[model samples]
Target chain A: AQSVTQPDIHITVSEGASLELRCNYSYGATPYLFWYVQSPGQGLQLLLKYFSGDTLVQGIKGFEAEFKRSQSSFNLRKPSVHWSDAAEYFCAVGAQDYGQNFVFGPGTRLSVLP
Target chain B: DAMVIQNPRYQVTQFGKPVTLSCSQTLNHNVMYWYQQKSSQAPKLLFHYYDKDFNNEADTPDNFQSRRPNTSFCFLDIRSPGLGDAAMYLCATDQGGGNQPQHFGDGTRLSIL
Candidate 1:
């Protein structure tokens, strides 16, 4: 079974400040990783995803993540964040079992200050 | 165009009442998933369907059930609404493969009174 761990429960950062959200996964083989953001009263929106090749992957809304096999991590990063960026972020790991079922982390809540 | 559409952005149901939420996708993906997200928690996968094939999570309680009659339509049925079941129900669709991204609908905010 595959699982994801997001150490940070809540993160607060000022506007224009850089941010990094840590995510680690436990899986037997190479897994597909994804980052999703959900605002209040809304469903999740895909921030980015990493399947293979190119350790660094770019996503919408000025977001990026690096897939490090050695570290077993795919941390989401942004150089500058807007107040609208404040939301709950989730890290997910997908495996090749039962038609690519994904296991998700608890989630990290981000609060951006003005 | 709306790739995924969930009817009744907000839904309120009485305790022990049965409620059904509908999800329709324009993407026409073969795979559709239903997730339950509580306050300050990650979205938990309740079940999913690959075309007409239904798959439910082991931990999913009997109170929760799902049905997908066609390729583009799916429904999440809550037999007996409980306070714990009150949460935002998200509908997502993928191309039935790992390489494709899972697109999500706006979700239905289910409130149990």
Candidate 2:
């Protein structure tokens, strides 16, 4: 079985500061990874996904993540955080085949301080 | 825009009462999933419908049932609500294939009293 671990439960950063959220996964093979963001009282929105291509995948809202096979990590990063970027972020891993469900992390809550 | 739609943004039901949540997708994806997300927790998959075939999670309680009459619509039915069942129920849709992104609706917040 595959699982995801997000070490940080909550993080606070100042506006305009660079931010990185760590994500680690345990999968037997190369896994499909994704980043999702959810605001309070809102459903999750996909940030980006990694299948099989460039290790660095760019997502909506100026977010990006790099798939590092050696470390089994796909950390989400943003160059400059905005106040609107405060939300909960989740890291998920999916199998390469069909009919399989994605395993999601517990999620990291981000707070942007001005 | 074509998207997944979940009805009743908020629901309040009494304990032991039966409740049903509806989800419809304009994207017409072949797969629809129901997930339960409690406060400060990740969304846990309850079940999913692939086309018309239903797939329930191994640990999903029997009280939770689902119906998918067609590809575009799915329903999550709880036979008897408990306090533990009070959580946000999210509906998502995805193409029934590898590497496809799942789209989610805003979700229905269920409150069991």
Candidate 3:
């Protein structure tokens, strides 16, 4: 079964501080990985995705993620986080097949302190 | 601009009552999906429509049904919404069947009374 795991359940960071959220996955083959952000009462917004080629991918809102094959990890990072960046982040894995089978990990709640 | 849009941003219903949520997309994507997301948890795939074909997740309950009248519109109907069904219902669209990035709507928060 393909599954994703985000180790941190909740994280608190000071505004303008660096942030890193770890994600790990288990799949039979190379899977498509993605990061999504969700604010209160809003749907998810795609942050970035890793299909192939470049292991490091940049996304909107000054976010980037590195997909490490050996560690089966796709960790999200930002040089600095803003107060508005406080939200729920999710890591998802999908098999490259006919039917859409996207599996999302338990979200990590991020809280930014000014 | 919002590509995917879900109506009734907030919906409240009585237990065991039937309720329907609607989603529309301007992307004209071939695939549409419905997901259930509870508080403090990840979103779970309920079903999806690839064109006119319908695909339901194996673990999805019988109470949950979906309809895609056309390429641009889709509906999710819960025959008997339980208290546990009180959660955010998200609708997403993609270009094709496989590994494509999806565009999500603001979602409808369904509250069961």
Candidate 4:
């Protein structure tokens, strides 16, 4: 079975500070990794995804994630986070086939200080 | 622009009453899914439709049913609203293929009275 784990439940960071959210997955084969952000009373927005090739992938809103196959980790990072960046982040793992359902992490709540 | 839309951003219903939530997509994706999310919890997949074919999760309750009348619309019906069913219901759509991302709607918050 495939599963995603987000180690941090909640994180507080000051504005303009760097942010990193950790995500780890357990899968038998190479996995499709994704990061999504959700604001209060809103749906999830795709931040970035990794299918194959490049270990590092850039996403919208100046977010980026590096896929480390050996460590089974895909961590999201932002060089400078703004107050608006405060939201819940989820990491999901999916099979290579689209028909397969995705397993999502519990999510990390980000709180940005002004 | 292509997008997924879910109706009734907030709904309040009496316990044991039947309620239906609707979802429509302009993306024309082949797959539409329903997910239930409790406060501060991850979204849980209840069922999905792949081009009119309904697929239910193994643990989904018998009271939960889904209907995809066509490619663009899907409906989730709760036969009896329970207090435990009070949560945010999210609708998502995706083009079925390798590595395709799913688009989500703002979700409908269901409150049982």
Candidate 5:
């Protein structure tokens, strides 16, 4: 079974500061990874996804992530963050051939300070 | 824009009362999924329909049932609600292709009293 681990349960960063949210996965084969953001009282919005090819993927709202195969990690990074960027971040892993399922990490709550 | 839509942004039902949440999508994706998300938690998959084929999670309680009458619509029916059932019910759609992304609805907040 594939599982995800997000080391940080909650992260607080000052506005305009750079940020990085860590995500690690346990999968036997090459896995498809994704990053999503959910604001309070709202559904999730896809930040980006990694299928194959480029190890580095770019996402919306000035966000990006790199897939390190050997490390089994895909971490989200941003050079600077805004107050509106505060939300919950989730990293998910799935396989193209697997059943329509994505094992999601517990999630990381992001709070931006002014 | 083509998107997923869940009716009744907020629903309040009494305990033991039966409630149903409906989802419709303009994207016409073959796969539709229902997920439950509690406060400060990740979305938990309840079940999904793949071109009318219903797939329920192993641990999903029997009280939670789902129906997909056609391609564009799906419904989540709770036979008897409990406090634990109170959460945000979300609907999402996928193209049923490898590496395809799932689009989500705004979700319905169910409050059991």
Candidate 6:
């Protein structure tokens, strides 16, 4: 079974500071990676996704993720985070098969100190 | 325009009483999914419907049931609400699989009393 691991359970950063969230996955075949952000009392919004080709994928809200095949990692990064960026971020992996089963990580809570 | 809609953003039900949460999609996606998310935990997939075919997760409790009457609507039914079932129920739709980003509704926050 494919699984995703997010090492940090909670992280706090000051506003205007750079941020990086770590994510690692374990899958047999080439993996499809995705990042989702969930705000308080709201549904999840897609941040970015890496299916194939380029290792670096850009997403909405000035967020980006890089797919590292060797490290089995797809980390989300933002040059500068705003107060609104504070939310729960999840990393997920999808199977290459037809079923396209997607497994989610435990998620990391990001806190921005203004 | 909101692509996905989940009714009764907050619901309170007595224990052992059956409650239904509705989700409707305007995207006309082929796959619709129900996910249960508790505080400080990942969202767990309860079940999904691909067209008319139903796929329930292996560990999903029989107490929780789902119905997809057509392409536009899906419902989650809790036969017996328990304290453990008090959580946010999220409804999402996708074209086929994870390759496409799944659109999500605001979700229904279920409370068991």
True contacts kept of each: 0.63, 0.69, 0.73, 0.67, 0.45, 0.55
Every prediction: chain A TM-score? 0.97, 0.97, 0.97, 0.97, 0.97, 0.97
Kindly report which residue stretches of model 3 are placed more than 4 angstroms away from their true locations once superposed. Answer: none
How big is the positional error of residue B94 in model 6, measured in Å on the Cα after superposition? 0.8
Candidate 6 ranges with C-alpha deviation above 4 Å: none
Model 5 residue B2 CA deviation in Å: 0.8
The candidate, 1 or 3, that scores higher on DockQ is 3
In model 4, where do residues sit more than 4 Å from their true spots? none
**TM values, all candidates:** 0.96, 0.98, 0.96, 0.98, 0.98, 0.98
State iRMS for model 3: 1.3
TM-score of 4: 0.98
Candidate 3 lDDT by residue in tens digits, A1-114: 688999999999999999999999999888899999999999999999999999999999999999999999999999999999999999998887765488899999999999
**lDDT tens per residue, model 4, A1-114:** 689999999999999999999999998989989999999989999999999999999999999999999999999999999999999999998887655788889999999999
Q: Write candidate 5's Cα lDDT for B1-113 as tens digits.
A: 99999998999999999999999999989999999999998999999999988999999999999999999999999999999999999999988853777789999999999
lDDT, each prediction? 0.92, 0.94, 0.94, 0.93, 0.93, 0.94
Q: Which segments of candidate 5 are over 4 A away from where they belong?
A: none
Task: Report the CAPRI category for model 5.
Answer: medium
TM-score (C-alpha) between model 2 and the true structure: 0.98
lDDT of 6 by residue, A58-81 (tens): 999999999999999999999999
Candidate 6 C-alpha error for residue A14, in Å: 0.5
Clashing pairs in 6: none
Arrange candidates by DockQ, descending: 2, 3, 4, 6, 1, 5
Q: Encode model 6's per-residue lDDT on B3-113: one tens digit a residue.
A: 999999999999999999999999999999999999989999999999999999999999999999999999999999999999999999988855777788999999999
Give the per-residue lDDT digits (tens) of candidate 3, residues B1-113: 64999999999999999999999999989999999999898998999998998998999999999999999899999999999999999999988744788889999999999
For candidate 1, the TM-score is 0.96
Q: Each candidate's chain B TM-score?
A: 0.97, 0.98, 0.96, 0.97, 0.98, 0.98
